[model samples]
Target: PVAAASIGQVYKAVLRADASPTGERMTVAVKCQRPNILETVTLDLLTIRGVVDFFCTVPGEGNKKLRQDAQGLLAVLDLAATRFLEELDYLQEAANGARFEREMNAVPVMRDVVKVPSVLLDYSSRYVITQEWVEGVKLTDLEGDPKYANEEGAALRADVVRKLLNAYMVQFLETGFLHADPHPGNFLIQPDGRLCIMDYGMMTEILPDQRLAFVEYMAHLTAGQYSKTLDDLVTLGFVSEELAKDPAKREVVGPVLAQTLSALYAEGGGLDKKVEILDQQAQSRIGEIGDKLEELSKEYPITLPPYFILILRAFGTLEGLGLSTNSDFAILEECFPYIARRLLSDDSPRMRSALRTFIYGGGDRLNVAKVEDLTRGFGSFTNAMEAERKVAVTGEGSLAVRSSATPSGQLDAATKELLELMFAPEGNYVQELIIEEAVRAVDSLSRDALVQVWQRLPGAPPGAL
Candidate 1:
């Protein structure tokens, strides 16, 4: 009753069995895949990819981007075709659902935040999967409601988002099996406030070794160790070993990655307009980056390993979800805890290398970005709030109020609440000063205080204290 997608339609039905836990008849979600969906998807991909190939072949102004990424386009379509075809297998989905149920069981603490419906194996077929029906408020509905837009409301949404993301970290970094598709309709807010996850048609399995490398790559990135991140990326196969070994082969990928990811996770940078800006950059920065890529590929390849594509897609999708929830959820920042836990809690050469890659002790410097972010957020809030007040006093809607903002306004709302917490009875602010600036978090508070006030501040992830 809730959803119909390209692949399937879900209907509410009552399943009957003598050994039913609740009764002889129990409500279940019956997901029936469209007949010959695989064929349909194949034909669609063929049509789209064919057109894309045509553009890549005929050199033109609008086709420049496609031409540049032509080979990659073909590879991605090929890879996607395989994955999309797999999504049509109801039996595989049933198994994926079962696996997720097992994962949920392993971490009982996670029950508060997320859940998986019970699958009825006997009722499942190659084209149809049946599982226990779950009733709850859709995640989008919770965010759409006017009441959940304030500081407290944002905090609640942020908590749920964090829990959901952390669970994903465990899946990708620890369990090695992830629900690759987490589009909005796949989630629900249970009556008791837990997140219910449904639809496991698309899942990614990260090989054990690949998972470790991913963790190392993330750790280095989080610590602002760009040089180390480059090495990790090379070792992870994003770059060819030939390039890593050849100094003559110029590569500016490290700086690009560092700047890109840093900007992405920077305060006030989550979701919101950043995504559009980044997409625009991809199209606009071609002249700047295309030459470097071409030169770099001469000595080495720039191929992304098969599994990495799925992982990256999931990451991007997560950002979209963050945008919807109006929460500042940083993917790399969130990865820190899970990666640290693994390295510190385990013993191995890989773990040692990962720990080593995590750099510490940088020269003290003001994070101008963080300050700029605070200023901008403050400005937006002041402007928006002032507009609202003007409307109330003048009895005229001359200016529009941004009360329904997605990320930009919501971030400021959360920041205002945190500033209240950051201040003390002593009448001074506990501003985030130099993040990793070696400021002692001791009795000497103010003189040592560094403002997290900007996006430039870096240290342990928030709440690590």
Candidate 2:
């Protein structure tokens, strides 16, 4: 038994002869919460917003970015809240363990290779989990294990890694739920070639749409449509409306993301000998993207949904752990089987629809109505430009006046009033749009007096910039 986390620690133990649930003494691992952790954790959860703010100040590239993107910050806090609450419930964790085991065992490819320790139901409680002590080798230390150093053992290790990745991919691509934390400590290699996955305290469940969006994201990348991939990313909550709609900022983001994705999957750093190569190469690449994203985050409202971030965390953790094994793990290849399986099945209507839209490009089938609308917009723009030229040449104010119901003086006064109301902390305006438009006018139009007032004010809307 070996591990420690924010909530608990694991220890090697043996059941007493008379206390055994099986009526025989046996080795077990006791997972118990830290002393008085619950009350403190609950207290901390109470101040979780401050916890989010604290993370924003934790000397990282995304600190300023996190502070600026309020929605993204909220998403982070939400994920943290869910994780902490789930981890605090030992009973919920026990249930998650059983569910995970069933999910794995239900899939034929994973049934034999994937394993979870049996819970000693009689010994478990609200603060403790007693499970069979598993004897398995650590992944990093597997290189030195005499029994697994040979070619045969290497194949077995590779197979195990494949199954592990596929199992998790299924959890992500098909099931919409996954083990949120899968760091090296939670995994082990059994003597008889089984992959033992432990710990179930943190489970993340995503919506079906999010799962389909994830698949769409992958399909775009596979199809070599980086721009479309980035577009899909915006829809999936990685890029925000502000960022996607801004050409200059999108230029800053697009290449960084494309390069990062390309480099991550590029030949040298998967789950093989190239793990070292990728580990070295990707560090700087990812850091560069993080820096750019963080800096841009101040000016553009960028956000990553919590589920997407959690999925990314799982993959990153697996990638880091796979690096230690010195084997090229084909994580992408493993995903193909299941994704293909889902697409071909009649039972999965969602997958079939997603396949048509994503894989076969069917959902985007040409529409006469959309074309007509585009044509109409073009005609309107053309007519408006000609009308503008005529008005400019004729020196006419009547046409422009007809477009506005409010007089210029009244509109200006109203805008000024709105701007003032927005900056006043106790103003309490419910129209979010008013503050946004007023701030945009004041900030962009260089209304010097309004600018002075805004400068004097302490706060603005989240995406005012």
Give me the overall lDDT of model 2.
0.62
RMSD of each: 13.6, 25.0
lDDT of 1 by residue, 146-237 (tens): 97778776766665565567668778877788888876667876655556888887888888888888777766666677767767777777
Which candidate gets the maximum TM-score versus the true structure?
Answer: 1
For model 2, how does the per-residue alpha-carbon lDDT over 332-427 read when each residue is reduced to its tens digit? Answer: 443544454443332345444444444334443433453233233323322322333333345452211112123455533223433554465654
**Local distance difference test, per candidate?**
0.64, 0.62
RMSD of 2: 25.0
Off by over 4 Å in 2: 1-27, 39-66, 69-74, 143-156, 241-260, 266-300, 326-334, 345-350, 353-465
The residue pairs that clash in candidate 2, if any, are: 271-327, 271-328, 271-329, 272-327, 272-328
Best by lDDT: 1
